[model samples]
Target chain A: MIDEWYPVGLFSQLDPAGRQTALMGEPITVGRDAEGNTRVTGGNGRTLPVRLRYGHVWSSLGEPKKELFAIPEADQPGRRFVDVGVVRVRCSPLRAVENFLDVAHFPFVHTDILGAEPHTEVQNYKVEIREDVDEVWATQVKFYQPQAAKSASGGITTEYMYRVPAPTCSVLYKTCPPRPSEWDVITLFVQPLAEDLCDVWPWMALFDDTTSLTDLIHFQQTIFLQDRSILENQIPCLLPLDPGMEIPTRADLTSVAYRRWLKRHNYTYGAQLVAQ
Target chain B: MHSDTTGSWTPVALSADLPAGTVMPVQIPAGSLALWRTDSGHTAASADRCPHRGMRLSHGFVRGEALSCIYHGWSYAQAGNCLRIPAHPGLVPPETIRVVTHMVEEADGVIWVALGRPEGRPPGLEGLVPLRSLTALANIDAIAAAAGGKTSPQGIVEVASGTGTICLLLSRQDEDRTLIHVLLKGITDQAARIAAVRSTESLRRKAEDIHKKEFAQ
Candidate 1:
């Protein structure tokens, strides 16, 4: 059940300091030894596999069947890779990733900053499960962004494309204000601390070089913090695949497809199969 | 008129702790409750879970006199009646859309919630005032052992401390923890208040240590 690699903490956060954290509700410590290698110890000094990627330290309770998902844009030169840090959300890990995939809450939760009233319309988007890579993708998602990016001065219609390579991870490619041709990549890596709780680590690789590091971190943190209250207060806490507990509109197609993919993979770690 | 099912009273929290237009989670003998106070200084206690999708009403917010769920902004009155459904503003919610509520009584800086009919009112701290409430990672027995006194039938355990007498009103929380509300018998000065706080903190530490040692065996 713990065969998949889940991120425990940021590599930077662990390299400089030892952290007491949990992975799938198992208390574990994340730190580096004297030889400069990642060390993870669970209850009663049980060690697990440790790896560093995408500015995060990942560990698996059991042998992972696959390596960490790839983010090619992270290594691309001239792109500012900003680590937005972690936020503990009292909701399922899959729910955190699905919320990142959702653009419908922009006007309601992120009002005025990302979207505003009267502009709260979600047009049709294409969603599918890619057979070759066994991933979920949603494309051609166009939304009116009051501030498209940190570098944007005015409103613009932003285009978004979402990719879900892992059950708890999702990547978003959105329209960049500075470079019209290139798309900014924002990725959410959720660590399921328990079936009803998770820690979300959001990383961004964008084309803009103007915004300072603190501003970039703060801008993303504000948006995520605004969402944290809503996530924790949701019913059942775990992500419900059956949609019986909730009413889905036309805009929830991506979420529906993602749930289907998760069910197909039998990723029931943080998923509620029934309505309750 | 309240029935026999709404009579047994248990001290849930302090009146000062729950401010106006705020909701807090509380646990009693019956179960968990959403203890809240309206803007007009009226208090209420409702079943912790919401009726819609079972969201914890304690995690919800209060606007004016109504408690609104944080998930979808479903508002409910202090009398356990549904007032507003933000998603469907035009439609009037049916009478069955109501939450189970308990009878609440606030007296002498303490708030008591009732699940069923009781013979008498909650114990009145006539001269004592509530200083603070702290959770101890120990059971009631461990806390009583640490205080060198037995808990009375009224849930009051008096400990003779160097800073005079400190009375702790214990409430069971979860499995191995106790919510202790510290009440000062006579001391109410600034220095005495600080001393009472220190005494309770020391008691909690000792109780937790005792509990850990006992469980480790």
Candidate 2:
């Protein structure tokens, strides 16, 4: 988990003095060098690799074998890149990613904004662990969402595809209300400050031209903040990898696959291995 | 601090503070627990975690005689047994899917939670009436010093006010925090009650100051 690149701060929102943050429980400072290039320094005064992608400053505590995962929509023209900022949640980073992958919570947590009563049934979805990229992906997921996006005028049955490129990162591709041909991309890049704490950086690449930038950020922030209360209040704080610890229904296929993938890779930083 | 297996009863809250059909989070030496009252006024304490998911049951709502989780709507009875699963309506949850429940008793306007099987009921404050409950960011020692009295074995600290003696039931929430339940000894009027409340507030402030100073030293 320490070897994976984690987002520290938004490139546009970094403080001049230095932005103080943590990665995998190690205190780090995110600042720019004299050349205006992003620099990350660990608590031990060791310089770490820094990558500026997805409008955020990414860093790693250890040597990473692979480069930061790519999001093709971020590079697409005419797509508005929305930086939704960071929300510090007192929960396991794995749990945050799992919650982001879950569609069943939309009706209960996000309420009318994402889903409403009687439309709570989560239809069967396909989940797979792609060996080619060593990533967990869920496709053909459908849910009834009210005001699917900031530009949505009414309710729509949203089509969603979720991808977990990294243990703590998840990118979501959902149906774009205005441009049905193209998908709206929303990504949750979680910085695991500790085993049970994280700083969630939610970024979006959308084809919406109607909503203002502030309105777009607010809309995303409102949705994420509604999830914060649920995330923080979850008991045990750590994500339980043991199947017996948490009972999952058919709607939790993505979560189950994610946990199994994490277990397969032996990534148990913020995960409870056995039932307590 | 009390052990979970001991026959010790910890004062969690005042009876008047926890109304029927409401749930609240309470902390004991062992850990945090969800204390909820059924619509029929039956109080129960269970491990805050839901068996299905780790969602805190305290965030759930009380419908009829069951406590329902806000996340997935899995309901639990007062005995901590899984009553229903909203997602799987027809299926009856297995008995193994149950939250750990603790023994609770309400007596003398105070709600007491037993860490284990208690040999006796909670101590009775015969003539005193509960005024209110407050949390002080100070240990029991600091509170005792501020009140100019020490706590009895029953966890009662008697401090004389203008009207009569006010008894404070102190429960150590953690190393630096204490829960104080104020009780009035005599038949006090509204003004005296207000004065007692003010005095308790002042005592808490003093205790917190002392605690801060002690930590600095």
Candidate 3:
């Protein structure tokens, strides 16, 4: 496992004692070091180190440059360091955001409000980040016409970025898009709970408006909760247990890529991964 | 300053602010309140302290018709009576064991909690709808001073903006702060509502700055 740093939120901005519960029912607390590095405490006392980061991420491509370094192997030799934390993932690089484009499931999964074809698909295009793993996501939109002026109705186009070992992700959604031609993306890093379970958190490039941020979050949360009920109830929750049933269709390409990516990276399980 | 002001009721929040099935912490000249609205849309304000084990009731979550404490999960009804003690499911809680409740009333979108046995019902702003409630870092006096007005006989400092005049219902949260309920005139434009939100935030910042500066002196 590489100690590749995936930028989440700023260490200084987040309170050490502040605790917020995720839609996954996992409560995470964030603390900052004197040097302004973030240490997120999850479930038990499990803490993950975080560094503030932002580089030329083409909202279109979502990749930062890679650099190499070395370190010493403990008890084996002298200073044998390794290439440290550098993220090169596409925007919204997790299932939580990728599955969001599954417009058909909205009606059956979340029956209350969001339904099938809530809005028309504005665009369906893909961009590849220059990494070992390829990534993609579709963007759809529902603009409030002059008639429904009260709501901040715009479009949401999310992209999914995939990075290896770090298994880090980026979830980017821009309003009134054609996403940002330059930059401005709400980046997120998805941490795996189990093989199937994952927690998506915000990155340095945060959602711009507070109210819009809350609304988008709650909407996504409602959808995530909708997915949780079905995913948790599924018999073979994890993929490795039943790879025998690797049936595929044209639309299942993304899911296939995700499964392949998980396999290529040493599949993480239980408390062992956190110690790294 | 004597803790309780006579016949004055601070607006803990507007009726629409709490929403159905939610509980929030609010404060007044008297003390803090665990303000909540039930599933049925009725509002209630009780002492922030839970009767069982003195947990902060505001930290409790609202479910159905009852609000349950975060600690021991002691549930209480809108009337402040202990309804269910989860650990003692078989035993019904006695009527004697109950939280100290306060008189709460909602009139014309504003929800008012009495300091003692206050005057008449909360003043009827007949045509105003509640926009939202926010905590401001200023005392009622400081808010009034910032607004260049006095706390109205009805306990509010009116900040008339280009966006249909926002009435600041100031409740002294503690020593140096007040909870301001930003309200808009009913039938105002959606644009006006947006402006109201912006206007109130600016007003709060000014009032808070005044309060803090004066305190330093």
Candidate 4:
């Protein structure tokens, strides 16, 4: 388990006048604010004062080490740089679309599973092998209670391949957050075209209606493009995955567990960082 | 500001919006409250004021089914009784130091906080489950006016979305703002749910913008 990559830094501020800064570090751009606060410039040159929450620009992308039955699910831990103020979230081995149940790692820490009650063993599990590249699709099936979910129609799945050297450029999964149940999931994946950049190319295969793939792509990219400035300026960018070195803390349980599982299975990637 | 004006349960939050173990600031006619959940994930609404320094209780964090104040680490039970005081770890806080409590109902997957003792439980809307809630620039009147309907005696507004009926629970966010809790009529496709949410957002923008425009003029 050897990860040659390193955490660039946490994205801090994306200020107008071409000044950006990375955290635990220096300014990536010029001076942050002409006055001392972030100013976001809109089309036609209109600027709005941007006030971000503490560590928001740094800790927006969720790192998942969830408890399935109150059992730590991450055999090996994961670390991600997060930025939520802008529209797009950039993660390494990128988790394109995180669903609701990705708990642990706070922002994504402590999520509840569906079809499977808390502490109940996963039953009726179906794994469908995909043909495109090489991947497995996992569907967590369950009947909905009137109190938890209003209806059940098409089944749901959280399908993705956690191949290292950066996870599958995107995640194909259905997501809803931790609740008592009673919600539908968005099944989609992220298509990463670059290490520092990617597109939210959404999937149109799961639904019944005729939503234009072009439209979904446009919508997702439009939002993320607006978020570029803020996300790129992170500090300790993405944490380097060092398989040889073991850094264990109580908080690292979930991430460490996930990483360990990935290593056990022999996940691999190419020596190239492609530019899309 | 008691809702003797309309005896009803008000929309506090949509199911998806309020994540577990976090306290979100919510509004009622009387004032705001620290609406949060314990670590085990149970919804509780207590007076927004921390008993110690009267700081906003919503500024606190959830430990394990109890909300702890951000300032002095004063913990309170779901029923609004003082549970623990960091200053006096072993001593049980007197009952009098408790913040006022509100009756909470989780009917139809939406968490509803009763402003006062309502006559009956929250209305069981046949099929709809809570989605998410967002603050709007418009108040109840403008929302109803924009939705082409009026608020029911219970303060719920029904809207027709993409041929499906969606119910909105409207509560005052502040002086000129309203917090909307949206739920669909019944189960439809997840895409339909998204459409309903989008439609409602469009309606809210129209209504709130209109209200703002009118006020500006």
Candidate 5:
């Protein structure tokens, strides 16, 4: 967890006035200099590697072996890029990512907005590790959403594709209403503050011209805030890698695959080895 | 510190803060507590963690007389017994599936939580009435020094300001923080009440500064 770059705060959250934030349980200060360049100081009063990418301030406490993962849709023009800001979640970062990948919760946690009763069936989906690139992907995921997008007027069968490029970053591709040919890219970047606490940063690149930016932001915030209560109230705030405590059915294939990938990387930063 | 199992009543909160059909988390010398009030306006305190999966019962919602966990909808009665488990509606919950409970007493608009079996009721507030409650980032000694008074065994410290006599009821939240409930001794007007509030704020600032200095030395 230390070697990898984590999103500390949004680019807009930082200013010349300066602010203090925490990453990986270490307190850090971020500010701008006279020339308007970003300056960061770690908990030990030492310089840290700071990078501005995808509208967030990324920092690494230890030496990072690789750069931040690239989202090709972010560079495409005419796509509305939104910064949903940071939301503090009282659960493990891995649990947040895992919850984002599971569509079965739509009928329950996100009722009426994402899914409603009578259409709560989760069809078969394909989950693969993609060993060539060392990333996990869940494809052919289809779910019915009463309001799929901010611009959507009616219910539609929303097709989703989830990609887990890193331990705490998850990108979702969903069917766009305005641009039916293309898909909307929504990403969740989690900064694990502690083993059982995290700050989630959600960014989206969508193809919608009718919806206002404020409405889009509110829509995403409303959806995520509904999940926050469930996330925090979950027993054992840390995500348990073992399925012994929980009963996973066929609908939890994606969650199962994600757990396997996390286990493969030995990403126990916010993972509980056993159910406590 | 009042660490005795009995005769130790901690003023956890004000009666106005916790209304009917609501629950909140509280910390005491014994451990954490899930303080809740039923729809009938009866207050109860239970061990915070759920017996099912260790979920904080403070996060649960109150429905009528039972508190239901948000995770799996496991409801517990006011007596800390598991009333119902949503997953198995037909099966009766075992007797062991119950949380530890504590004695609660509400008087003079202040909510008192007992650590163990108390021999008698909570200490009387006499004619004093609770005004407001606030948390200070200082221990009992620092707070008493700032208020120019000594704390009694009952955790009541009387502070005299220019406006009136304000009594500070202290409850140790942790090592550094103390929960203080402000009470008025006599009938006061609006202006006097405002002054009491301001004086309490000043006392908190002074006590925090003294605490910082003590730590530094």
Candidate 6:
């Protein structure tokens, strides 16, 4: 977990006075150097590796074997890259990613907007851990949403593909309402301040051309704020790796697969190893 | 007051404070509880977690007679049994999918939660009526000092006021905090009630100030 890259703040919104943040419980300061490059320094006066990508500043405590994951849609033409700001929640970072991977909660947690009553069924989806890239992917996931996006006019059965390229980060590819042929890329990059605390940075690459930037940001923030209550109040405050700890239904395929992958990689940070 | 071996009850909240169809979080020696009342005025205290997903049931809403989780709308009955799962409407939740519930007794306009297998009933406050409950940043000792009285074996502190005698029902909320339910004795008029409220507020300020001084020392 220490060797992984985590987003601390959006590059465009970094404080010139140096924003104080933490990574894996270690306090760090994010500021810009004289050359206008992003600089991340640890509490012990050690300079950490900084990578400015996906409109956010990334940092790592240990040396990362691989570079940051790629989102090709970010560089595509006519795509609006939105930095949805950060929301600090008192929950395990892994739990935040697992909640993002869940589609069944749309009907309840995000009622009327993401989903509504009578359409709570989560269809069968395919979940696999790609050995080459060492990431968990769930494809062909479909859910009935009332307002799937800012530009959505009415209810639509949204098709989604979720990917967990990093331990604390998840990228969602959902059917774009305006351009059904293309997918709207939404990502949740979590910064683990402690085992039971996280700062979620939600970014989006969308094809919508009508909605204003403030409206688009508010739409995303409203959806995530609705999820914040659930994330904070979950009992145990840690992601349980033990299957017996939490019961899962057929709709929880992505969560089940994600937990298995985390256990396989020995990613126990912010994870409860045994049932309490 | 009963012996510890026979178990004891904790005054969680005033019955008037927890209205029908609402849920609130309360604490006891065992842990936290989701104190809720059904729409029909039936009250129950359950473990503050949804059995399915561990979401705090206190954050959930009460629908008709069941407490529905805000996360997935999994409703649980006041008896702690799973009543419905909105995600899978057709499936009746298994008997194993039930939250743990504690015994609750509402007496003298106060809600008491049993910690274990408590005996007898909560102590009766025969003539006094609860005015309001407030949480103080000070402990029981500081509160008693502020009121110029000592706590009785039943956790009641009596303060002689200009209008009437003020009765404080004390419950230790945490190490440094106390939950105070202020009751009035021989006071019924609106003017007396207002004076009691003002006096209680002044007592709380003094108690908190004393607590801060002790901590500083």
What ranking emerges by TM-score with the best candidate at the front? Answer: 6, 2, 1, 5, 3, 4
Worst 10 residues of 2 chain B by lDDT: B1-10
Ten contiguous residues minimizing lDDT sum, candidate 1 chain B = B1-10
RMSD of each: 6.3, 2.7, 18.5, 19.8, 6.5, 2.0
Per DockQ, the best of the predicted structures is 6
Worst 10 residues of 4 chain A by lDDT: A67-76
* Residue lDDT tens for model 2, A1-276: 778899999999776678988888889999987777778999999999999999999999999999999998899999999999999999999999999998877877888888876677778889999999999999999988888889998899999999999999999999998898999999999999999999999999999999999999999999999999999988678999987888887788999999999999999999999888
- DockQ for candidate 5, please give it: 0.11
TM match of model 3 to true structure: 0.43
lDDT of 3 by residue, A1-276 (tens): 223333333333466564343212345555555775455555666664433433211110122233311111112222111111222221223344334433323333554344322332222333323254333433332321221111224323323322222344544443322224422334434544334555445432322333353455455455456554443332223333124332222333444454455445553331122211
Worst 10 residues of 5 chain B by lDDT: B1-10
Candidate that beats the other on TM-score, 3 or 4, i.e. the better one: 3
Kindly provide the TM-score of model 4 when superposed on the true structure, using C-alpha atoms: 0.42
Docking class of 4: incorrect
Per-residue CA lDDT of model 6 for A133-158, tens digit only, reads: 88899999988999999899899999
Q: After superposition, how far is residue B155 of candidate 1 from its true place, in Å?
A: 2.0
* Candidate 4 chain B worst ten-residue window by lDDT: B1-10
Best-performing candidate as measured by TM-score:
6
lDDT accuracy of residue A137 in candidate 1: 98
Better of 3 and 5 by TM-score: 5
| Chain B TM, per prediction | 0.91, 0.95, 0.86, 0.84, 0.92, 0.95
Winner on lDDT between 5 and 6 is 6
List pairs with backbone clashes in candidate 6: none
Q: What tens-digit string does per-residue lDDT give for candidate 4 at B53-90?
A: 34567877898788876534567889888886643344
